[model samples]
Target: MTGSGHRALGLAAAALTVTGAVLVGTGVLPPATPPAPPQAVEASHPSRGRTPETGSRSAAPVLPRSEPRRLDVPRIGVHVPLSRLGLNADGTVQVPPVDRPEQAGWYARGYTPGERGAAVILGHVDGDGRRGVFHDLGRLRRGDTVSVTRADGSVATFVVQSVEQVPKSRFPSQRVYGPLDHAGLRLVTCGGGFDRQTGHYRDNVIVYARLA
Candidate 1:
């Protein structure tokens, strides 16, 4: 999609401060990484005329709106409860409390986990010398599974499509927060070289996944 066609979701300049470092830096988004394999594309895109068996990672049926209760990334050993995150007074997205590094925050104003749009979840990579909920977010590879449990007791399972680490200055806001035809999930956290001067990571690690 053309960049201009997408909504300039306020997340473009969103940032959150952790204990002493910035977790999600301003204007951060996914990297300009190579496109995922064909199978992954099929899964991320709307099913349309294709049948389920056509793609091993075919998108799952969309679910009604509901608050996410938990997030699980079995491969990375992440099983944490989700907290509702909203915009800060200045319009940037809010982050989980610095003391609660084990919890991840879901963008409450965005699409729900099982909805036919990108649902964003944010966490810190590390804070106060402790590992954050998404410390291993960079380890997720294509075809991996990430699931979110909703308040309705249903789980929205997604197959990982790509993992990228990009500098905050080059954050692709359109691709990250833009509208999607199928259910998608985005897990984001700080990564790359840490700038001791600014107390923030130089890059953002973004994991893109599609419902399955």
Candidate 2:
């Protein structure tokens, strides 16, 4: 979907549940305060965004034995605790308390970083003038390093491969939030541009990375 279309879809979804502090509004008002999420659900990685298999099957990502607890981005100088949340009925993830509007905590109860599948983390770009944790996420590029401090006190590195700003309308199901050949990381933020009437950012920025 086009960038503008994402705002429409996201706002439409937000409108339904009357989302709490995390209103998912335009850049004008203060960003909504995200809510707490449920525990993590353990599952294997799915091959939704992989190259089509010819006659042979492909291998999947091997998750680390230890789970991740903190995330660090040296390029951006970010060292923050991880938090998680489940998606609302509209498919948008519930927000978490981090710092700025663009930043959010991971749904900790769910998938851990370096797990067999994708570890999803989301934040807002700017809400009502407040900047969230992932506000600068759009700046990430392939090869950029994302380090995670695991619950076991071990650090794992990931290499970024893609940074896409997709419209909320055509959510990148397989592309943005899909599983990896091994443990991976998914970073989400609301960006592109802002709309006054719709009360939502123009596009959704997603950062994809694989364990290093």
Candidate 3:
């Protein structure tokens, strides 16, 4: 996908449960850097995390991690390993080639949930008939809960604030990519129903949630 394609794409962190890689070989993405492996922390229920609905780390954390170890959704009782990468210098998300799509995940060197700006998480909808980690991202609703386990053994929780379906032709880049100035989370994935022709959904579904 081109820069235009990326802007039209939705990469809601929560929506990652049903997302995938974009803009390969665009030279627009940044150089890939492996994570130094975040300190491991025990798992905790989203409720047991920092303050609810307004914790200090409630916003998205963009700290470097060994990798995105796990992704948890309280509302849907969904927990899965997160594998993927953020945009490079260009507007592309590095991911496995379509042949080995399931192997794709986040680069793990970008951000963590509940940091500064919006913590973005991405994934594939389906690969080889096997649903991707975020295959069911669209099921998320307002007031739902999403959790990410950081390497420093700290866990941040976020509460769903809103879900929007935007046409790929006009994605809310600044609103989504701009600095949050507060802890936040972005769950991105393809939606508005899948489009077989383009091999992607026509609209990007972004679920905006705040650190709770």
Candidate 4:
């Protein structure tokens, strides 16, 4: 897609996914100097596609306010602790440390998981020449489960409804981040192909899930 077409969605998704850092930062491990492989890209791209229809009944009941502490995706073999992330000085969502690519982060400014709005989580695909958290995110399928442990020692489970890949230029911000009538989850990662010149990905992979 042309840069012009991606500008708006790019900015919106960037505001929430920290895509600018992926485009410019070197994917090197902290306290080390070795240059990371070119393919070690962050999982972030501006993207949006059709929103999945919400079912009347959810498998899990929505809980009250609680911060997420851990995330587990059995299908992807992901079991990682989560850090709370806020916005940067530039007003974009703050991302997990690049050196600690194995970790994932939750957007603290938005609704907590199991609430009535869409909860967002982000992770890197690869860095420091190794697989990063969410590297297998694209492998998740409908009906797969994502479990998030909250601060209250409660586990809120979400079932995948759909997975989509859309170009950054066509990112559907409203569909992705807009208010939801039910508790929802969105997992975002960089996909498609890497753009060597821009040091970014051409598309984003989003996994939509509802409380179950």
Task: Output the number of the lDDT-best candidate.
Answer: 4
What is the clash tally of candidate 4?
Answer: 7
| Cα lDDT listed for each candidate | 0.68, 0.56, 0.50, 0.69
Q: How far is 73's C-alpha from truth in model 3 (Å)?
A: 0.8
Clashing pairs in 4: 6-169, 43-190, 44-190, 46-168, 48-172, 59-212, 60-212
Write model 3 residue lDDT over 88-172, tens digit each, in one string.
Answer: 4443455544444334354333345666655666554445444444445666766788887766776677788666555556555
Any runs in candidate 1 off by more than 4 Å, and if so which?
1-8, 11-21, 24-60
27, model 4: CA deviation in Å? 5.5
Per candidate, the number of residue pairs that clash is 0, 33, 50, 7
lDDT of 4 by residue, 1-212 (tens): 23542343344454744453362134433232222222333223323243674577545367898999999999889999999877667766677776777889887777788987778898876666666787777778789999999999999999998776666665556666666778889887666666666656666667889988
A best-first ranking of the candidates according to their TM-score comes to: 4, 1, 2, 3
For model 2 the TM-score comes to 0.67
lDDT of 2 at 88: 59
Candidates, ranked, lDDT: 4, 1, 2, 3
lDDT tens digits by residue: candidate 1, 1-212: 22431222444323432211357333223232222223322233322422122244344578888889999999989998999887777656778876666779887878899887778898977655567788778778888999999999999999887776656675545556667677888887877766656656666677888888
Shift of residue 134 alpha carbon in model 4, Å:
0.7
* Model 2 clashes, total count: 33
Could you report the Cα RMSD, in angstroms, for every candidate shown? 8.1, 10.5, 12.4, 8.1
In terms of TM-score, how similar is model 4 to the real structure? 0.78
Model 2 / residue 32 / CA error / Å = 18
Flag regions of model 3 displaced more than 4 Å. Answer: 1-68, 84-91, 96-110
